[model samples]
Target chain A: MLRVLIFSIFASSAAFAAESGGMPQLDPNSWVPQIFWLIITFGGLYIVISKIVFPRLSESIEQRNDYVSDLVDEAKTLAEQTEKLNNEYKELISNSKKEAQEIITNGRKKLNAEFDKKKNELDKNISELTEKAEKEIQSFKSNSIKDVQTIASQVSGELLKELSLNDEIDQNIIIKKIEDISKKKMGELN
Target chain B: MANPMNQFEVKTIGPKIEIGNFDISFSNASLFMVITVATISLLFIFATKKKSLVPSRLQLLAEMAYEFVAKMISETAGSKARPYFPFILTLFLFVLFCNMIGMIPYSFTVTSHIIVTFALAIFIFIGVTIIGFVKHGFGYLKLFVPSGVPVVLLPIIVVIEVISYLSRPVSLSVRLFANMMAGHTMMKVFGGFVISLGLVGGWLPLGFSVALTGLEILVAFLQAYVFAILTCIYLNDALNLHH
Candidate 1:
């Protein structure tokens, strides 16, 4: 099929050349320069485009896309880190608050215990002082009673010697002496 | 009286240069090819100088041309070959503009010539071949042999594949040259009829000329599209090496 087609083209060219009065029209040589020139031109153009122009364009596009993606990833990472740090800070704050509360509660308990201990010691000291005062009062009363008895006995002996001379005066003297003795004992006890 | 075929004549300028056995002449055809290149370059430069989001008229046209070629390449060759969109777009625009510009009052259609179209086709052929080799190296040769072919028919299939590969350029070139030449020749012949018939009877051929002119315009665009699309297909084969 292809041979037939090629043959017809060459044949047509031949016929055209023949009809044109052997003027060397549509000659193969006429087309040779054009063919060679075309090959050279296209070859040079393709090389320049493939090697230089296309590579530059493609690289620029790829670089732009990569830069954009990198920026997005960086933003995402920063956001995640920020969230993590915020959570950590919140946890620290909550823990500190709980610790502070616990310390305050423990301090109040210690103060209350110390206050109760001081109150118990003051009560015991007051009781011991009152008991000592009672003992001293009892000793003073006993000494006064002995002194009063001796004095009374001396006075009675002198009075009895006088009464022997006056027997009738003894009854009135005894009664007066008894009354004075009772009064002395009551004053000493008070 | 104007001749219809007169437009196609190769007019020599100054003196012909002879190099050894070859006698090469620079004619109106070559001159117009250079003009075509310059015109296309200027058109693109001027149109695309301020490529706006909301395009101006010229920018709109330029963008439309770009979009047309881009879509064609993507649709025909797939997304992997989308990188070649610029080259293919430039080829399409240059060819399209040249063909359309030739339809002007007194202009030469460079694409009508086999040498010009063949140059383009052969360039694509060489480029595709180089790509296949560069990508797959010696393995590129495997493209010629089918995998599922029976042992008995292997020789025949291989021969067919080789022939097909070799004929790619010829088919690619001939398809463009033939279409442009045939359509322009028909337009010229019809134009001759309109001129030969004087004012009273001329209206009939004049009307035919108008319709033929519109048809020629469509053919011009169609030829460019066909040439570019085929180039994409060839490039696909080079890239994928599909059977």
Candidate 2:
């Protein structure tokens, strides 16, 4: 069996080591195999790692780094765009507010001017109508006073005629006297 | 009871194979090396299979390892060491996996062996040296001659510098091998005590073994880190030729 052979080999080697009275590492018989295997295994490892493992790891790491930086760049650009939009929005709002305020002020100024003009026109019309009415009343009062004096003098003449006293008085005198009396009565009333 | 050294003993796993005078038969050490290599390769391959933007845990692990070694190279050796990233990553992962695998009960620790670590360190030393020559020509020899030393002290200083430079591989290899070997051996020794002390007295050694296992795991990671960083430092010296 391989086990027995392995055991025998171990036993023989152990005895040989004992006979040599030294460490097995110092044993010359084992050095060749150890070095040979070391060269083979280390060489193989170096090749596999350099050719395969290292490249893959570095590639993935590089990929992750690139992805992260790209994300950051995208986020930065997006943030910048958002800020630009925000500034535009703010400017638009302020412009509109200014325009609205200007419109309101202009409208108020126009309305105030129109109101002042209309009020002045109405005041002038009212004063002109009042003056016309006052003139008409004054004219009517003077004419009515004249008519009353004429009627009084005519009635007096008729009464005098009926009484046969009008022929004794002068028509001119009667008219003059009525005029004087009316003048005096009017002055007193005034 | 088994000898604690028996765990370190190199044993043939399959039928012996010979090429000329060399007995380069498959061994437990070899098996573990294959396992370490296989595990690392598979884990990474699987981890990066999706390569998704959002990483899974396995992918995160693979990336962390990549980043750790990448940072180590960039920091210690600078950008000039970029070409050597794979080598450093492989070295770090290999030693790390080997140490970690060894922590598992009954698993072989490839890095615990001196020949294995010495092989790696010597390879790095030779490779870095060759890189230095290739990059800087013979001017790389100026590494041994300090710039600030006076003419009289230059000889002594250069000698010291040369000796230190030569000892880089030895120190690098020995540091890792000794830390791993000592930690594993100590754990094994305590483990032996736990078994021999019986149920009533074994709790103490058991506790120590548990604590030691934790420390050994930390040492395993630290040793791997130290090994990789030192290699980076060496690479830096060779590339930059800094005093």
Candidate 3:
């Protein structure tokens, strides 16, 4: 195949170049030192990495992870506390609202009872005053009627004397006569 | 034109040291390896020094690398592979830094060499095998005998499976080494063209070199990812014995 040919050509050229200036890699003399140094260096590196480097890196990484997780846990607890406080605040607000509503209704009921009692008291006082005024007016009318009757009697007697018709005029007779006459007139008018 | 291969050459630095028969002298490769190790160690150490709840940029970088490998292992090999996080992270960071550092002009790529990658890969392969055996005992051999094959084809299938299993290290190491080496070599080759062609005519190769540099950077990250993921996959095979 063309691929094989190309590879052989490349290999031959590499060999020719190798033969021209001996490949240092093929020199057995150098291998000892290279291998020796390689063991020392590689072994030293392995120890350093395994013992020193790995533990340090792992510790730091583990520490970071632990710190981050602790922070997250604290944040979660804090969030829960906030939610609890918010719920408590809402409950307090609702409780105060309910108490305020009860207070307002109780105050209105007390005011209404006082208002009704005062209205009843005012109605009674007004009725008592009107009844007293009516009684006073009735007594004054009776007394005035008595005074008018007496005056009528006196007037009749005087008029009889002045007229010179009858010298013996009895006041009671005159008064009775006047009263009967007036009664008859008043009855007739009624 | 400068030999692009010279960039990979190992040069001794300071006094040479020998232990027994081996020439274990400190070289540029060794220096860079130390750099790679020290770079990761210091960066990570500094990043986590504060251990602040909120990570700084450097800390974020370190965490990202850690999480990246952790996620890769968990996804590929399951949570049972959690213990291997440090090893996989080290491997990934080491390879990634080597490739990235190599991207700088005139710097050496430690992983571009076969022996280095091979060593790492062979180590991983052996470690994974040991884990599989430890975890499953003799039952780990069931990995070579997949399920739902015809009895007649079982022999062929088992042989193929065994070969592929054994080739894991070679393939794993070569894939990273070849990619790094080829990309660097290609960039070097194009860079040579830029100089030989002179100012007016060299713009084309210069543009290609620039583009190839970007691709190589991507390849650098990608190869590291592949190397890590492949290790996770092999670990998965060992841990779970996937059909």
Candidate 4:
């Protein structure tokens, strides 16, 4: 299609130029200056594009990607560290609680043992005092009994002296006196 | 009959300026190039300003253009050349726009001029050369000689490779300029035929014009793609210095 177009254009242009008695205007040589100018312009453009512009744009994109990834990694690391620290704190709290519970149990056991020891010592002291008191009471009772018997015998003797002038008339009365004396002795013993 | 080819004739926009040895004629072609540059800049700026997650129509168009060139560069020059996406994209759009604009009535096609196309080609040539030296230093000369050639055939292979390498700019420039110039000239001739034929007989030329328009549009896109792809190939040589 393009070739046909070119041929038709050339054929028509040539016919028209010849009919007008003018020189052919679209000769190849006429384009020499234009070609040189194109080379100069395109040369400069290509240099700027490849060397400076393209490199800078690519660098910017790479830098941006790196920055984003770095940010994400930093955030992930921080989150992990925080989680680790939290676990450490939880363990510390649990260990301290267990230690506290052990201390309280040990203190209660020591207190109960001391209380039992003091109660046993008090009971032994009380028993010894009771035994000594019982012995003293027994001795006092025997002494009192002996004193009463002696007093009774002395009184009987004095009575007999006073009654000596009338004694031959009543022998039976004497016997009765002896019996009363014995009875008095038994009462004093009781 | 009015000559359609007359539209392409270079007309002076302002007086010619001569500053010492410099002779400058600012023509309609230059004016249109300036317009094209301005239009491209404005369009991109507007399109990308409010970049959305789900793109607006304008942003979609802009992103599509970017993705298109990016894919092309990666495909042709490998992923290493993805960095050159913006430059390649700009070149393709600018050239593509210039060609399409020239197809419009009374519009001057800057790319049709040999000077414009050659300029682009030479820019690629010089740039690739510089990259080769910078990347491989003196070893860049090895690009002209393959590594695995037999000793007897080495010189012949090297000569052929060198000739092929040197002809890159010529072919690149000629391809673009020839395509644009020929397409536009033909369109002009057919347009002239339509005008000369009365309304009763003008339908044939009209139908041809429509078909030609569609084909020209396709050619415009293809030429820009070819130009950019060739640049990538040249860049690859510079970067890798492969035979």
lDDT of 1 by residue, B153-189 (tens): 9999999999999999899888877766666665666
- TM, chain A, every candidate: 0.49, 0.68, 0.66, 0.49
Give the interface RMSD values of the models in order.
7.1, 5.6, 1.9, 5.2
Deviation in angstroms for A21 in model 4?
A: 9.0
lDDT of each: 0.70, 0.88, 0.88, 0.72
Give the per-residue lDDT of model 3 (tens digit) for B160-234.
Answer: 999999999999999999888878877877899899999989999999889888888999999999999999999
Choose the strongest candidate by DockQ: 3
Error of 1 at B179 (Å): 1.1
Off by over 4 Å in 2: A1-20, A147-190, B150-152
Pairs of colliding residues, candidate 3 = none
* The candidate that achieves the highest TM-score relative to the unseen native structure: 2
| Residue lDDT tens for model 4, A1-190 | 6567577776776576566543223534334433433334444444544554344434444555587899899999999999999999999999999999999999899888888888777777777777777777777677766655575565567456646756565767766776776667667657
Cα lDDT for residue B230, candidate 4: 90
CAPRI class of candidate 3:
acceptable
| Candidate with the larger DockQ of 1 and 3 | 3
Better of 2 and 4 by lDDT: 2
Report how closely model 2 matches the true complex, as a DockQ value.
0.36
Candidate 3 residues lying further than 4 Å off, grouped into runs, are A1-22, A126-190, B14-17, B145-157, B241-243
Question: A50-82, model 3: which lDDT tens digit per residue?
Answer: 999988887888898899999999999999999
Where does the lowest 10-residue lDDT sum fall in candidate 2 chain B?
Answer: B181-190
